[model samples]
Structure formats: C-alpha cells, structure tokens
Target: MSPADTGASTTVGARLPASPDSPTDSRMAPGGPGYRRMSLALFLAGVATFALLYSTQALLPLISGEFGVAAGEASWTVAAATGGLALFVLPMSALSERYGRRTVMTASLAVAVAVGVLVPFAPSIGALVVLRAVQGAALAGLPASATAYLAEEVRPRALVTAIGLFVAGNSVGGMSGRVITGWVAQEWGWRVAVGVIGALAVACAVAFRLLLPAPRHFTPGSLRPRVLLGTVRDHLANPLLRRLYAIGALFMTVFGGVYTVIGYRLTEQPFGLPQGVVGSIFLVYLVGTVSASTAGRLVGRLGRRGALYLAGGTTAAGLLLSLGDRLALVLLGLVLITAGFFAGHAVASSAVSRTATTGRAQASALYQSAYYVGSSAGSTVGALAFHSGGWAGTVGVGLLAVLGVVGITLCGTRAARVAARREPVPAH
Candidate 1:
C-alpha cells in the first residue's frame, strides 16, 4: 500500500506518542515554562551539528589548491565526514537509548565542536580528512537524540511546532555556514574560514547546554545486541520500508553529488566566479527549506507516488538546465534541484516513519544510515565524475540517481496495485 493509505500518522514534524510513564500535564507545552528555552536549545544544537558537519564543503576548491590535490581526492574531506556519521550513528543512537538523550546530545556536541576547533589547524590534507571524519562521528548523537528527546519531553499537541523550529535551525545553519565561509575564506583563507565556523559552533554548543531544560520524562532503554539486531532485521525485512529507505538514499545522492561538484564547476572555465559568489550560490538551499516544509501538502494533493514523480522530474530538469554555460541558468537550475531534493527527502523519510509499525527508532536510524552513505558516495563519485568529464559528468551522475528514485517509486506503485487487487471482497 502507498504511504498515505497506511492509516499511519504522516506528519513530517510530528513525534511518536508519549510514553505511559509520562503524564501529559508533566510534559512541556506551547505556553509552558521552559518551552521556549527547550526549543532554542535544540535549535542551537541543530545549527552546531550541520554548520560544523558541512563547513568544509564550500571550501573544497581552496582545500584542493592548498594541498595540490585533485578534486576527487579533496572531496574525501566531505565524504569521510559523512561516511563516519553513517558508520557511527546507529551505535550512538543505542547509547542515547541507554544513557539519555540530553546527555548524549550534550556530549556529542562537546566532542564535535572540540574536533571542529582542531580542524582548522590540520597541517595536511590527510589530517584534515581524519579530523573531519572524527567530527562527523561525534556529531551523530544530535539527530536521533534530539527527536527522541522531543517525543519524551514535549506535549504531542505542540510537538510539530517545536520540531519545526529545530529543523528551521538546520536550514539556516547550512545556508549561513556556506555563505559565511565563502566570504570569510575569500578574505582570510580557508583555515581562518573554518576557524570562524568552529568558533560559531562553540557558541551554539555552549548556549545549547545552558538553555536546554532537563528532561523530565526520560525512560532508559535496553542496550542488548540481540534486541537491537532483531529490530533492525525486522525493519529491513519490510518491503515498503525498504523502498522508502532506497528513495531517501537516492534523493540524497543527487543532492550530495550536485552540491559537492558545483563549486568546481562555477570556479572554472566560463563562469570563473569568486569564492564568495560561489558560496552565496548555496543560498538556493533556502528553496529546499521551503519545499521540504510544503511536502506534506504536496503529498496531500498528489499522493505519495505522484509526489515522487514530480520531484524526480523537477530534479532531472534542473540537471539538464544546469549544463548550460549561462550563470543565471546555472543558478536557477540549482534552485530547482534544491527544491526537488528536499521535498523528495521529506516525503520518503516521513513514509519510513509511517510504514514501520514497531521499532520506529531503529527504522529511522537505518534510513539515516542509508541517507548519509549516499551522501558520502555522492561526494566521492561526483567529484570523480567532475574530474574526468567536467560539469556534464557531474550532471550525468545526478540524473542517473534521479532515475533510480523514479524507478523505485514505480515499483512501489506496482506493489500497491497488486496488493489492492488481492484484498478480500467485503459482504455486499
């Protein structure tokens, strides 16, 4: 069955129901004391997580120039960080389950920011990549823990708005980080640019610690291998969930590849844009923020499969448009690509939540893993494609990934139809 037909709650920003041990009155609500603090704390945490995670992306060309490395080799700085996050996120989530979300998030931010501080000081390309990988692994705790914390501590009625604020922070962080780094790196060099981001992350982390209210309704979960493995196996076994996971991965592959290589494309040949101008181009990410927020409405109007198709088509068109030499066309293409990717991601991820009947956290974690793995792959492969075949090669990779999304969505539509036909007839 399609995700909308699953009879599951599909609100993208909504959390799981509160635990029975936690009374509704005890949870934070919209107007309750500490609500704003809790919201701001998590918001800052989100900012720190993403801003630090992607700080090097806008500086890839500079990194390449500094180290005399190829684009594909420099891309590892981005790939290694995402790969580390993918590898460690599950284990970190398990830790949060046992230790508590607030503790895990606080510790994660502390470590990630510490690593961020050291990143600007790396003397070699290898050292920088290693530091970034460590920083990514350290940041893994924030995503799942922040969501779980909200589920446990915030009222169900106010959950969506609270989570929305945190997500907004992520968008702002990503855009501002790239933009800030672009201009900063232009004047002060990439090292100082990264150092500025590190300092910003430190401020965010400190405010997160001070402003976040203590969790009043946390219940510790088990850490047994057998239990966790069994849950993961069950999630992987579900066909619908499997498809949603693949969809998420494919969408991210397109996004990761395009953004990773765009810097090189704009800085070379006919475009020859300045570092700050190239960085400002990432303001297209703001389109993603809007598109992702409207995904629920799009799904409501178009159904899940229809929304996927539209997103794919939009992405493919963007890829084609971006092949031109005109700078305006390239910028417009980027905006379209950003919008399509974020909308598709929002739909697929929400579908994963709706499809899983139990072990929802594990289900989401698996999706997160696939998503970041795709990011790492895209960063590495996209740069390789660009190195070999220029802008067209990078666009080729994205188009193929978008095709994968469409093909998978088609399979889902077929499966839903087959399932519908097999249902038993009701008494007339």
Candidate 2:
C-alpha cells in the first residue's frame, strides 16, 4: 500500500530521523541486551516458522502409505502450506506495517503453533492437507515481517549480521525438523512425530514472545488499496529490485525442488539408504548456517553485487556436483547447495531491505511471496520430475534454473553500469 494509504501521510509529523542510522529515538545496537534479546526472538521465530512448516516433509513416504496416495500427492502436504504462505505474505506484511512488527510477529507465532497442534488430529488426508494449508497461512506472518522489522529497528551497520543470524536459525530449524520428524515417525508413528513437533513449536513460540522487544522505530500506517498499489508499482518499476525478486524466486525453486524428493532419491536406488540415514543427509544444512553468517561478512567486504555473484556460482557448482553417482559425492553436493542457498538468500533479502525507498515491509513481502511461490511450484515440479526421469532430471532442471539466476543477475549489473555511464557528470 502507498504511504498515503497507510495514513502515514497524515502522520507525516512522525517523519523518520534525518539519518536512519541515527534515529532520534533509542534504537537497538549491535551488542546491547535489547539487541541480543531481539536477535534471539527473531532466531526463535525463524526456527518455529520453518520447523512447523516443514515438519511433514520427511514423512512423505509414510504419509503416502497411510493416505493411499502417490508421492506427488503426498507432497501436497508440504506444498499446501507453502502455497498458503505464498498467498498471504503480501497481505500479512501490509497488516504488520499498518499495526506494528512485534505485534504481528508474535501473533503469527502463536497462531502457527496452535494450527500445528491440530495437524496430528486431522481425520483424513484431505483434512490434513487443509490443516497444513491453514498452518502455512498462519506461519506467513514471520518471514513477511522479520526483514522489515530488522530494517526499521536495527542499526544499518549491523543489519547484515542480524539477518544472517536470523537465517541461520532457518537453516538449523529446517534441518532439525526433518531429522527429528523422520526419526520419530520411524519409531512412534507420523501422528506422534507431528505432535511432538507441534509441542516444540509451542515452546519456541513462548520463547519468541517473551524475548522479543517491541518496535521503537516503527510508524504505523493505513491499509488503503491505493497506497498499497502505488507502493507495489514503485518496487516493480525499479530494475534492480525486479532482478532481486527474480533471484529469490529462482533460488528457492531449486532449493525446494531438490529437497522435496531427496529422501525418495536416497532411499530407493543405488544408494539404498534407510529412512533415518536419509534424514541424516539434512545435517548438511548446518553448512548453510555457517555460510549464511559468512555471507554477511562477504557483503561487508565485497558489497551486495559481488556477494550475489559468488553465491550464485557456488550454488551452480553444487548442482553440478550432485550429478555424481557416488553417495559421498551426493552428500557433499547437498552440503554445497545448502550453504550456497542460505548465503544467496541472506544476501538477496538484505538487499531488498537496502534497495526499497519506501514500503520496506511490502518489498520484503513481495520477495517472500515470490520465494514461497517458487517453493510450492518447485516441490510439485521436482516431485513429478523425479517420478518421471529420476534424480538426473531433477538435478538437470535445478542446474538450468541456477544458470538463469546468474544470467539475470549479470544482465542487471550490466544495465546498472550502462545507466551510470549515461548520466551527466557534474561540472568541476
């Protein structure tokens, strides 16, 4: 929504401090108690949202068996939630902008946990899919609001580090959710596994609520359609922002596609690994936790453009490696790809917050919406590809997608350079 729609225009009296980095009000600093608390809250937010959302992923085989559905259909359990998250992210971001960040985020966590608590009780496959979709929609609140919250409240110099830590939480959460659920499902049954995850989500949600500091710098706005539409127009018109959004979409497509069917791939064929062993492969996500933090440092050292190029190259290399037939090579490839994915995501998301001139929440929301849309589409497509042509086809598609990302990013860079050259030089 537009600033006008936010009634931010009416509250123009509440202008941002002359310098964002130097807000008149006290802002959270890098190492203060408040800062640490905020980071922990966000980190737990990342954990709860991702863990609750993907908890069903590792149980697809068992779910399919109980539901009497195909793998692709079973995948809908994961897809439904992502689809719901994708659909509501923009609207939820608007809500957070209109109300307040901490309020929106805390509510999101509580609602997501509540919905997750209900999934184990779903009476049928259709009911479970419906509940998962609702759960996903509930989970949309965090990602939609987190980056914008960081942008508005954190010091500019410390922003990248904060984003990295938050994403590191996502990496750890995603990995742990799959591993825990997979192992638990093997022994106790899928219902018990999911119920345990929901319980964990409840605990994380409580921690998130207790630790999060309220937003000090946020200015609430009106949720008018005109304002929203105008804000969307501005971002879409920016060539660089458009390219960044595209990168988010393509990045997650490959990530989602690979992880969607990876369990099936490892368990079925030449590798012939057991379910728990298949789950262990996700431990590679710890590599992503490190790479995300490193990406922050890289951005500080090399700037966003340089960091993105390197991250994309790393992802491409990982995809190529995954084509190997040996089990060790496959695991190594997963580690590389997971690292590259988080690195690229951390950079791109921070870039969105940096790039937007206004409606920071909306910009972040748009990026997340694209991200989850890619996820939903990628999971389904990847499942279908794996079913048809095997892991070879899945990797092939991912490689092509990563290449497309590189091409777009490079083209955007060239355009920026050309635009720089065309600008008139100041008279000396």
Candidate 3:
C-alpha cells in the first residue's frame, strides 16, 4: 500500500470512539484547530535544529586557516557534531518516550541553542569541536520527538504534508546557515558568522515554544533498559530495515562528504571563488527540498526500488560531473547531488517507518543514528581524502558511496524477486 494510504488506515483507526478515560480522539489536521500553529512551531524547531547543527560547515576553510589546522583536522568540527548526534539520538528518543515529546524537544533546543551561543567563543579547534559535539547531542531530541509528536497529534491523512513542511524547514535552515556564514565570515569572520547563526537559532527556539500546542495525545512509555534493548534488537534483526538503514547511510555519506569538501575545492585553484560565492552554492539545497517533497510521486511512478535506482544514478552522474573544472558544471553537479541525496533519504527513512510495526519510534531513531553516523564518517573521510588527493579524492569517495547505495538496492530487488517466487500462486 502507498505510504499515505497506510497513514490513512492508521488515522481511521485512531479516530474510532473510545472510553471517556482514553486520550481525546481529536487530532490536528489541515484546516483543523491548532494545525497551523503546530506546523509552524515544528517547522521552526526543525529550522533551529539544522541551522545550529551545521553552522560551521560553510566556514570550514576559514576555520582551517585561523586554527592552523589541516583540512582533515578542521573537518572534525563537522564530524564531531554528527558523531555526537549519532551517539545520543537513541537515548534522547528514549527520554522523549518517558518524559514527553514537547518537553524533550523544548529542552533539546534550549540546550543546543545555548551551546550554539558558546560555539563562536571557543578558544581553540579542540574546544570548538567539543562545543559542536555538545550542541549536536543536545539537539538529538528534536528529530524523533518531532516525528512522534506529529504522528500522535496530526491526523494521518495530513501526516505526510506536515512532515514535508518540517523537512523543508530543515533544507532551508541548512542552506541559509551556510549562505549566511559564507558572506558574514567574508566581512566579519567565522566567529561572528557562527554567532549570527546561534542568534537566529535562539529566535527560532523561542518562536517554536510559543507556538506549539501542548500534547494531548502523548502517553508515557516505559524506560526499562530490557524493553528498549529488545526493541532495538528486533529492529536490527530485520533484513529489510537493515538494508534501508544502510541505504540511508550511504546516501548521506555522499551528501555529507561532498558538501564538507566543496568549500575547500572552490576556494582553491581553478575556481578561486570568494567565500560569499562558495556559500551561495548551498542554494542548490533548494533543489533537494523540491526533490524530497516530490519523492512520493517519484515512487508512484517508479516503485520503491526503481526510485532508488534513479536516485542512485542521479547522484553518481552528479559526482562524475563535479569532477570537471568548470564552475558552471560544478554548480549543476551539486544541484543534482543534492536532489538525489534528499530523495533517497526521504524514501529510505519513510520505508523504515513503514517497516516497523511495533517500535516505529525506535526504528526511526536507529535510521537517524545510522544516517548521522554516515554524515560523520563522510566528513572525516572526505576531508582526509581531499587533504591527500584533492577534489578528485572527495568525488571518488562520493562515487563509491553512491555505488554502495545502488548495490544495496539491487540486493533488495533480488530478495523481493525471490520472495515473490516463494509465494504460492493464488487459488483459481
């Protein structure tokens, strides 16, 4: 069944009358009371989460010069953050289950923004990486909590659209943070650029808190270690979930590696682009936003595996195109890469949510953890490759990751065919 149809079925079940003591059946839907407020609040939360998370990415070159660090060392600033998020996301999700989604999200944003404010003042690269890691760990509560919140509060029929808006905010935040840092660092410095992003995050956090309605649908979940471990084990044991998780990680590996190294490439040699211009390159993320939103339609046309193949091919093509020295070709390549990465991520993440029947929250958390781990690995590995072998090295890494995605998808296709053959024919 289609993702929306599955959601609709779940919503229909949720709407059925229950005992008076049960949680209220009313849910936020398009045109329903509190819907706009909820959407806007969560959108802002998404903006704050991402803007603060990658605030340093566009400034990596500047950071390298100021700290007297190599490309790989400076990349730790990015990698550390993503690694922290990967390590802490599941624990944060567990906290959300025990406490409350809104509460956890509010606390997460508050701590993350606070850390963001401190980021610009770090005394050294080591301090900066530590602060970024702290900020990332703090922000981990937002993703799974926000998804759970929407699933519980928003009607299933409106779930996909609502989630899409949230994801769009993420894209906007990533693009704007990089662009803003690029120009601002050119004028003021990387410190001030990051400070500006921190301030923006503060504003988003405040707006988010003010606008979000209190949760009426949330029920406290068990925090027992055994239960959590069992849920995690069950999810890990599922081959489909394992494949989806790997696909997500591989897609993000390409995206994270490329973006992390692109600034360095542009600032050097053939391109000789200014910091502001390098930052503006992130505008290609708007293409990702569009591609991600249209993923469902793509799946409708191509089916899941087919859509994955298309995304993989698109990313591979982009990686190859980016090998060229021409500025225009590089920009177009980034556009294609962003589009493919976002679409693949959307498909893989959605598949995770659909695959897990009992532990949807934990399933999503695992996928997210894997996703960020890829980001972390990509940042470190990509930068190291660039340090030794230049832009070609980074592109080579991305291409290999794209190949991994394609390989996994092919395996999924073969498994599906095998499973189909194993099924008995329908009775006459």
Candidate 4:
C-alpha cells in the first residue's frame, strides 16, 4: 500500500500530497520542499559515507611505508573496510526495515565518523585494518537505506535524476577526499590527512541530520531471519534484478581493480608522480560527477539497457586507452573510465528500485552487498594482478570484467525470457 493508503503523515519539512488520484501524490513531487530536502540530505550522506570509506585509498603508499608491507598487503587497509561493509550490509538493511531509514542512516554516519577519527591513531597495522573493517561495517547502513528511501519517497519519473545526483555526490566526495588527503599527507603527515577527512565527515553528518525529512512512508517490519532469507531469494529469482546484481558486481570489480593499483603505478618509474600529484589523478572523478549527474537524462533518451551498453563500452574504451605510455592518454583513459562507472552505476542501481515489486529495502541491500563484495574481491585480486604483471595486466583484467557486464546485460535478458516461457502455469 502507498503511504496515503496507510494514512500516514509526513514530517514537518515534507511535501503535501498532490491529491489522491495523482501519481505525484504517491511519490515526493519533483520540485516540492520534501524533494529538495531529501536530495540535499542524501547527497550529503553519499559524500560523507564514501569519503570516509575510501579516505585510505590515496594514502595507501604512505601506509605501506609506515607499516612496512608489500603493495598487495598494504592495499588491504582499503580492502578490509569494503570487506566489512560487504559482510554487514544485509543485516544493516534488516535493521533499517525494523527501525526507520532516517534513524538508521543518521546513526550510521555518526558511528562511521567516530571510527574514521580513530583509524589514524591505531598502534599497529593489524589494529588499523581491524578499525577500518569495523568502520566499513558501520558505513554499510547508508547505501541500502538511502537507496530504499529514494525508492520509497521519490516519484518514478524523478528517481533517475535523484539517484544520479546522489552518485555525483559520491564522485565529488571521493575526488575531494583523495586530493585533500594526498596533499595534506605530502605537507604534514598521513595522520593529519585522515583526521581532516574525519572532521569533514562529522560536519556532513550533522548537516544530513538537520536537512533530512522524517520518513512519511516507513512501515516497520519483522526482523526474522526467515523473512530476510525469503526477501533475498525473491530478489535473486527475478531475472532482471539478477542480471543487475551481476552488472553491479562486475562494474565494481573492474573499478576497484583499476583505482586500487593505479596509485602504485603512478608513483614508480617513468611517470614517477608524487603522492600529491597521484591523488590529483582522482580529479578525473570530476568527469564522473558530471556523467552521474547527467545519467538521468541519458537513461530517459536511451532507455536503461541502452544506457548500460554505453556505459560498458565507454569503460572498455577507457581501459584500452590506459594501456598507453603517454601521461595525457593515461589521464584521459582514467577520465573516461571514471565517468563510465558513475553513469553506469547510477542507472543500474536505480533500476533495482524500479524493478522490485516488493521488499524494496531488501532488494537494495542485495545490490549493495554485491557491489561491496565486488569491491573487496576486486581490490585484492586486482592488486595481485598488477603486482604480477603491471599496468598492462591490470587493464586487461578490467577490460575483461567490463566485457562480462556487457555479455550478462545482453544475453541475460534473453535467457530470462526463455526461462520464463518454460515455467509451468499454476492452476487457479
């Protein structure tokens, strides 16, 4: 049932109903006060969540020096957080279903910031990894809840734009965080760099709490293990959603692989860029910001499948370009790849909400679970590949991963139809 059907009231900052008959009433209207508040808050959530989650990325080299580990092992500092997030995303989603989206998300930011603040202070590499892992687990609360909240509150027509903007916030946060941390680490130390990021995250979290409207559509649900399992099975059984899950995993695998090792590459030999300059490479993420923010219009014009194809192709093209020796070509390649990732992710993730008929939060949680698992696996494996064979091998793996996304998107759709035709009809 709709929120209106449940006779629920919105928080103070929410939009009024457009009328019972209008589709707009079923959603937060495109230009309403609630819509603005929701967008702003989620944008901040995206920034704070990702910024804190990935703050260690640009500092991996410094971390390697400080902790005296190989590049692959040092990369784990980034991997542990993602691994923890992957492990706990579903449970956090279940918690959101039991409590409320806003409450859960607000608390997530607060706790993650606390952890981020402590990460730079760990006495041992083992302790640092452990702290990062816990921080990752705490951070999982935002993605599932935020996606579910967008699905629940925003109108269908506005969903793509809303998701796009949210992703743009992610891109901007990632870029800014890396640049800030790298520059600061170059001048003073990695500890101060991370500490600054933690401070920014705290500020964003506070603003998020103040700007976010309370859930008008939330209906609390049982937290039974059986119910959670049933929801997972249902999402996995849906052909389109299943394909989307694959796409999410594959996309992040390639993305994580590329970014995880690129830092190591730029800091060595021919290019020999400084840590600060290497972090500047993330400035390419600005392209991602634009692409993500524009993805809604792209989907509108090309349809979801078409947009997915474009994104995959763009990423593949970028990976091929990155194989070059010239710095210009390499930077250009990074730009294309980053832009493709954000655009593709925005469309694909939003599609989950559009496709699910029930258990929207669970469905979103599953998607995020796939995404983070891909991140965890990709970071570890991608780094290993780079360690074994250098940039060529890394790009090769990334290209193959993108091809996998394309194949699944095209073939999976047809396979789903054929399977549907073979299902036996149930008698009434």
Question: Which regions of candidate 4 are displaced past 4 Å?
Answer: 1-26, 415-428
Whole-model lDDT, candidate 4?
A: 0.85
**For each candidate, C-alpha RMSD in Å?**
3.8, 3.6, 3.4, 4.6
Candidate 2 per-residue lDDT, tens place, 82-105, comes to 999999988899899888888888
Residue-by-residue lDDT tens digits, candidate 4, 18-53: 453265575676777688988888888888988888
Clashes of 1: 0
- What TM-score should be assigned to candidate 1? 0.89
On residues 9-109, what C-alpha lDDT tens digit does candidate 1 reach at each position?
32222343434224545678767889989988987897888788889899999999999999999999989988888888888878877787889999999
lDDT of 3 by residue, 119-182 (tens): 9999999999999999999988988788767766776545556666777678878998999999
TM-score for each of the candidates: 0.89, 0.94, 0.92, 0.92
Best by lDDT: 4
> For model 1, which pairs clash?
none
lDDT of each: 0.82, 0.83, 0.85, 0.85
lDDT ranking of the models:
4, 3, 2, 1
Minimum summed lDDT over a 10-residue window in model 1 is located at 6-15
